[model samples]
Target: MLLMSRTDNAVQRFIFENTDIRGEVVSLNNSYLDALEAHEYPEVVRRFLGELVASAVLLSSTLKFEGLLTLQARGDGPLSLLMVECTDQKSFRAVAQFRDDIVEAPLQTLLGKASLLITVDPVKGKRYQGIVPLEKETLAASLEDYFAQSVQLQTRLWLACDGQSSSGLLLQALPASAELSADARSESWNRMTALAETVQSSELLDLDHETLLVRLFHEETVRIFEKEPVRFICTCSQERSAKIISTLDRKEVESIIEEDGQVAMDCQFCNHQYVFGKEDIDSIFNEKPQIH
Candidate 1:
């Protein structure tokens, strides 16, 4: 069966038979709603968060390692930060930060002069990071530029989200094999990308996987694969927070305890707070000698 049964929470990948074109489709519901429940975000911020969540999931599907892909956008604007992280397990988490006075505006208007930073951290290897200026107005466009610059691959992405669900569609041209002519691969890539551009955001977000695929690629022979489930899984814990506090200098730790009564750390992704008192701080630092 080329079309897998719908499981309500899975990411689907597909490949064209005769073309060196591959794609991914992801729809996030429960995971996305859980992230939004952590805070009261403005509508614009929520929408941006949804798109980001979908984009991260789509990109993570392309990886072949046990790692995490983090997409972050930072700018000096009302909406200061937005981030989404996806791990090899297909787990994901996301959050956004904005000023109190942030008004409802389009994403470009909200995050002017921003930059998209993508970081890949392998479980046992050195981390890789890429920084791309937000030259395009939309998240999808900027990510397309990232693929162009970093991977030298032609890519197209359409990301969309309502308050309840987030979804995205991605198409990338595979590199030509040694046996294939470069011109032949390039021509196929161009044709495939043009077809991919016809995918509408509404279709991507609302239609069923089979219906959407047939609608978009009915003219071409395509092979669809089984879907992978994507879910929200936070990596924050009290132990992790304590370890973070242990790294700070004794004086700085003491100052936080003195001013706030306890050193409190909050996970930006989950809004889970960890509080450590003076005694806890002392225990963490007492074992190590001070560096003079």
Candidate 2:
């Protein structure tokens, strides 16, 4: 069964007519699966990764900047951390860390006393970061709180993932023009949020963008924009790994060589391992460092 069609593997933005409401939809299949294959995550971690992947895509699509957005969750549970990063170029990467015997449970069950951290890094500008405590029952609810606090906008999000495929929908009230009254904008936001809350996980993950829009907002007119492709691309290599190794003290490097006969570094995002034996370490120490 085809979970995501080639034509459907893009981020889409839409706006409602005669209202200050905007929304985005993202369906990730290949990118979601690629992130999963990078590590042997538990079932709970897998689900969290899926949600993070979908949420990252949805958030990146709505932003009006050319940069990267990173979504991460850290907790004091069996599942320690989960992260997803996506750039305006449509490239992305993700990874998760968890104990082997993590129980299969809901988002709250797996991540006790957790927090969500979002970072936006522009290619040529200042970066922005937001940290929100995980007080809600689900990842989607926590994100809604983040949006409410950061943007002060009425926002709703529906996120879902089934190991292989992940998808999400986000709707937010836009800042109204000077002519529009605050009460009018508030009323419109409440009405649209009510409509957005009825979205089912099955519909969000399985249905295409057009079908989803029609099912959820048939009563309203929404202008759908062209979709942008989302893909999985890891930015890790031996050269980068070597550069990182160059940062370590020479004593620390020699200690690893003395204990294990070699030093190995693995890319958490791609699972690509780089090994440096004594000779490799010597060459690294002997050669002049190049600016990376």
Candidate 3:
């Protein structure tokens, strides 16, 4: 049977009625392409970036604070770093840094001795960081392990990317309640996740959120909330770029301008260029002369 095209970059949250289980389904289209266009990434890097962006959006939806959630994977291999950031407003950006000669390979080979760092930087509260070993063959497995250990929630993630579009499904067991016994909650979680495990990668990438949810949980009573828009919003601007130059020593800034006539700053996440001419450099240094 044929499926309709998936919805635009958006996320949908759903909860099983009378059960302690919740889920989020996300599909990324233009947002994924926006980040991909920032750099000429290899196939393996593209695949991993897509999946990581999806996961970041899914995890960000679970946060209640007003700040940013970052997922960073660092290692000493061909793939050095894979970073994705999602803000509380449902916007996200992703970037990947790898060797120039990187090639598609197994996950472990690309990211040797890696660690996944999940950081929650609240706008008004203390920031928190969690480190999880990226020993699993797949990113989803490593995230699931992190949730199991930190949040104490049984979380399962299914992430898929075809080097173009990406999609993810997250199912998490809510806290045990007085009304729902542990045994009952376990049964519910098991049944729902088992049904979810039957989902195909193509379905996730092609089907709309509501269609996919109904197809998976038609038998179960699911209450889906309104869809939230996800956008590719980069936090880069000329003002921020100017601050970069103001932090450097006066001689260093002048040396760069003397050598190239101007200092060009490129935002790695969005590939936006911010050029500072002599006048602009003078203004920055004049405003912040403490930068000796």
State the lDDT at 202 in candidate 3.
Answer: 93
TM-score of every prediction relative to native: 0.91, 0.91, 0.94
Query: Judged by lDDT, which candidate is best?
Result: 3
lDDT of each: 0.84, 0.84, 0.91
Which residue pairs come into collision in candidate 2? none
What would the TM-score be for candidate 1 when compared with the true structure? Answer: 0.91
Per-residue accuracy of model 2 over 1-292 as CA lDDT, tens digit each: 4544323457889998888888999988877787778677766677778888888888887787998899999898777788999998778899887777888887776777799999999877899999999878889999999998987777788988878788889997777763198888878788778888898888888888988888788998889999889889998887788778877898899899999999999999988999989988887778736645
Top model number, TM-score: 3
Residue pairs with colliding backbones in model 1 are none
User: What TM-score does structure 3 among the candidates reach?
Assistant: 0.94
lDDT of 3 by residue, 224-251 (tens): 9999999999998888888778888889
Candidate 2 global TM-score = 0.91
